[model samples]
Target: MSERLRLYSYWRSSAAYRVRIGLNLKGLSYETVPVHLVRDGGEQHTPQFRAANPQGLVPVLVHGSRTFRQSMAILEYLDETWPSPPLLPGVARERARVRALAQAVACEIHPLNNLRVLQHLENALGLDADARSQWVRHWIGEGFAAIEAMLAEHPSTGRFCEGDTPSLADCCLIPQVYNARRFKLDMAPYPTIERIEAECLALPAFDAARPENQPDAA
Candidate 1:
């Protein structure tokens, strides 16, 4: 029996974008429930959405009667369940390396520049547009600098973040790159990242999973 998969996603949300990439890579057909993050005071804050995920975040995956939160967790679940075209490598050491690379973007870089953080900067910190943009750029630059060094110096770096195939790291990295470019961060400083992103985007899965290509993209 095929498990029914449904994804609650926001078009521009990087977290949601990561899940989309994972789903596409696994060749899984899933329904996308567009959760408009910016319309009418944000749909993710609605009572119904809050019940689904108390965190009020996008990329909530409903698999059968089970619900999953967090994009990284969802990716791991899907990979374990499907097991075709695996998202992580076979070796334990390589899996840890891939996870570390993924976390470099997802955990370190993304948290600082997420929508809620930016909203807090505006509503609480009273930062204007320019200052907020600078804040985002600073954090992204700092994280990307470290990631660039990691990728440039590592022997495992190839067409993707780990080896020649796209893994969980690629799924995470591509969305962060998208968000960084949206904030007008210069890509020239990270040639290795740029090369990997180019390779990932060339695939049909990544291209189809882009924010602009989502059903609810505004």
Candidate 2:
């Protein structure tokens, strides 16, 4: 149990950023092995990294002999491995709510706006820089609009996406919020999300996990 956790991550990948927040929130120590996503046609696609993750994605976590891929799965693994400071709520229904909130961002929002999809748009689809930016803003706006309604109307929405404490939902949401702003998406419509993001960032855990704070972020 003395083994140090290791994370293969790209600095600005929001999926990777999500796992970083989860790790920090759990107070777990981990070594980050930087994988440059944009330089030299992407280090993640190289043979060495692909052996660690067949999918060639960021946030492949290694602990002892165990290797975990996919950011949400890694979060669940960490929560279960170190049960104190639970990422999901204790109650079954509450857990479901948290999972749904997390999935809305991880599943709905992220897949549409992730690096690969955007790259495909620009390379394969021949979308200009402006056109790609439009594509990003449009999808993010659509997702945030639904999320805004959910958080605004739901009684469970606290300072974070779920209760006042940062949960699985906030871990997923915070990184996406960062990415949205990077694309310059107009955030005025999602006041609830904006407030929750501010609250989450106030915590040391979330603050430490910002993409800019990552060592590879240059």
Candidate 3:
């Protein structure tokens, strides 16, 4: 807790949202440096941001003088540093399960539907609004369907994605559900996913990490 912490975040960025939830759950205090991803050709693309992260991405965490990029890495870093209320499970197999569930969303689902991809789909490929909507829905449905099976059939599943208490998977999940709803994907198909999302949001940490609650939401 001695070292100062700061997060470079965009309001609606799902990757950033995941880190926000992790920090909140750990009860750590940090500064939020809002980097507007959409204002004036994205502050993230500026030379300054690229200096912090050559990839030009948000959710960069500065712990002391060390800088960390990529949401998954940041989450693990927090969990390892704090070691309280553990973002990951203790058992080896359970930890693997938690990470697998998280990757199912982070790797399989989000990459296909992130902002840059959507923008390229519309602006570069000239997809119409309806086509874009279809694109979002298709990818979400594909991912959610697999996640639904992972949760519903697995005995380890509980109130949250991995267990009753929130874990790394829940951090990845809530934001993706937010995106799914924004794109008007029907929720009826993924009852388990909806139920887990509700449980996670009921906690103050997850609620505060929501897109609308961030200072730079506009």
Candidate 4:
């Protein structure tokens, strides 16, 4: 085994979940360093955590002497450094398509619904619980609508987001779908997303990376 790979992760953090899924898909073993975002006014805000990630985000991957942040960056790094069981395709166009689909969830959908952002909507903007819930549902619906359209129309979509093999798209989709389900977002409109998530979850990699399966899960 390589020297212990340390991951700063929060149990319910969808970004962290994406990295965990990537690591598992590569068959790489790692140690979990739980970062409780909700406790003590957000442990990620602490100086030490901030030192690892100036942005104070969870899912920072420390391998050997190098530390990486951003879920998509970490996933791409893992795929590049360890090519076996590749999470991306060999073709340039196909790879771009896969990354775009992943970004639809990671960049476009997730940020607005992240824990810190929601906390801001409550504490900063003074949005009540119902309003916050509406905010969450609105973004999830907008993102999933695009995803559903792509999955339905894209000829590249197969059993998973891209072709039959699980790609970066599946990694991103599963976690976002999990978050959507948590908020009781209606999945009826996104049958393709639901089907893809189900297929990915059936695999050992995605199953093992589930939030509840993590050590820090409440």
- Tens digits of per-residue lDDT, candidate 3, 53-122, equal 9988888999999999999999999999999999998899999999999999999999998878888998
How well is each residue in 193-215 modelled by candidate 1, as lDDT tens digits?
Answer: 99999999999999999999998
Tell me each candidate's TM-score: 0.99, 0.98, 0.98, 0.98
Question: How many clashes show up in model 1?
Answer: 0
Residue range 1-218, candidate 4, lDDT tens digits? 37679999999999999999999999999999999999889999999999999999989999998899999999999999899899999999999999999999988899999988999999999999999989999999999999899889999899999999999999999999999989999999999998998899999999999999999999
Where is the poorest 10-residue window by lDDT in model 3? 110-119
After superposition, the stretches of candidate 2 with alpha carbons farther than 4 Å from their true spots are none
| Candidate 1 global CA lDDT score | 0.95
Clashing pairs for predicted structure model 1, backbone only: none
Highest lDDT scorer: 1
Off by more than 4 A, model 1: none
Please give me the total number of clashing residue pairs in predicted model 2: 0
Clashes of each: 0, 0, 0, 0
